[model samples]
Target: MIGDRLKMLRKEKGLTMKEIGEIIGVSDAAWTKYEKNRAEPSIESLIKIADYFQVSLDFLLGRTNIREPQFVEEANIQSEFLKEFEWSKIGDPSQMYFLVENLSTSIRKYNEHKVTELELQLLLKTISDVVLYFNTLAELKEKYKSITKEVLTEHRKTLSQIIEDLNNILEEAYKDILDGKK
Candidate 1:
């Protein structure tokens, strides 16, 4: 099941086992063994693989088919929100504009497809939460802009940590797509 999911996820990302191996600092043959279920990764290696693939360890271990632990639509919204927020942090005005446009389009598509009210509520709530969080970050950025260089450096470090967290979330979303949950 693990190998099957790994292979499925690799293809879904339009990546090959070799590409994944490179990301995890493993050889293609070693990755092939992973996909073939001929060898299991060590626990640490498994975590690295999960981190590289953006999937939960549970999913990697075949504990659940639901790689994202959230509804499919909500997962997509979260993924898109994270992507937009990350881009915005990098000072990309176009990315911010596209993020809003994409959210609008997503809502319209959901309505056109007759998505359930509950699902719509969940997606909207998720988006709202993300927006509020970004707003808080924006407020902090404004407040910190005039701080001393040392403080600014620390703030930058915090932002980097935030980006790392977002990357992990994105990896999990990628895993979701691989598991056919998105």
Candidate 2:
């Protein structure tokens, strides 16, 4: 997926592999490997590639179809959170977009070198897992809607703890990345 997008972007820019290699300080052969999907760029290189192509990591990896590097689509996050909500209409799009825009912008800033590459990847994975968990929880809730109140409350508590744990992980990472407090 990344190789395909990289190839397309290179072609669109009329850049030869050798040229891009020079621009990125890699061998032409290495660029070929990336385009062929035979190898992956290190995160730093991936960030450069994403920057050069004016796209997102999510887009290069085909995690999303939107090609422009905008705020990670709130629709993606909202849909994941509400996919199984029988009462999906209860979701407010404006609120969801506001949340996602801030989260995604922080990530984009991280990618721009506000944080180290490893930390940026950590942020990406953390947020991706969060979205995944939200989607899965929605499914589980929809599936077991008939459960008793006690069971539902237990589920809510368990999920709350999981979310708290996830947030803690992210918060610590931010401290290390932004505050240099590892």
Candidate 3:
């Protein structure tokens, strides 16, 4: 799906693969593979392409049909799982908490040359707001097995109003750090 979207966007702009690759600081072959879906781009490269095309990442990924970037739903969790959901010790929520907890540790290590800035940023956005919502839902599901669909729908709306995407979260975190709020 990404390959198809990438090819379409590239053609629409009348740019050759090589030209776009040069613009994005990637090799022509690498760009070709991306279009062919033979190779997966790194998250940074994905972000770069999304920004370059002025298209939302979800559109490129075929997760949504919309093209506007800001309106992109970074993640969508169906209120109902395909199968019966079960709580796990290594669930997404726990992993998200682990990631947040280790953020400071990563920064300390990076200052001491243990990790790179790339690693630090990746760690920070590892769990997007959508993921946080899903994990919260999962926790609630564990406790309220009989919750009605209406309640879940209302909860989704409430969460969406408050939580922003991982990108925004990173931006806020950076602001907090710079403003001595971290």
**Root-mean-square deviation of candidate 2:** 11.8
Instruction: Give every collision pair in model 2.
Output: none
lDDT of 1 by residue, 12-71 (tens): 889877888887878899889988999877787788877767777778889766675344
Give candidate 2 regions above 4 Å deviation. 80-182
**Winning candidate number (lDDT):** 2
lDDT of 2 by residue, 31-69 (tens): 999999999998989888888788888888889877776
Is 1 or 3 the stronger prediction by TM-score?
A: 3
Instruction: Report the lDDT tens digits of candidate 3 across residue range 1-182.
Output: 89999999999999999999998889999999999999978889989999999988888899888798764542233212212232443455644445544755777888997655665565555545446667778877887787878557858774664454445546644765878886
- Higher-ranked by lDDT: 2 or 3: 2
Please give the range of 10 consecutive residues that has the lowest summed lDDT in model 2.
Answer: 82-91
Candidate scoring better on TM-score of 1 and 2? 2
Q: Quote each prediction's TM-score.
A: 0.39, 0.44, 0.41
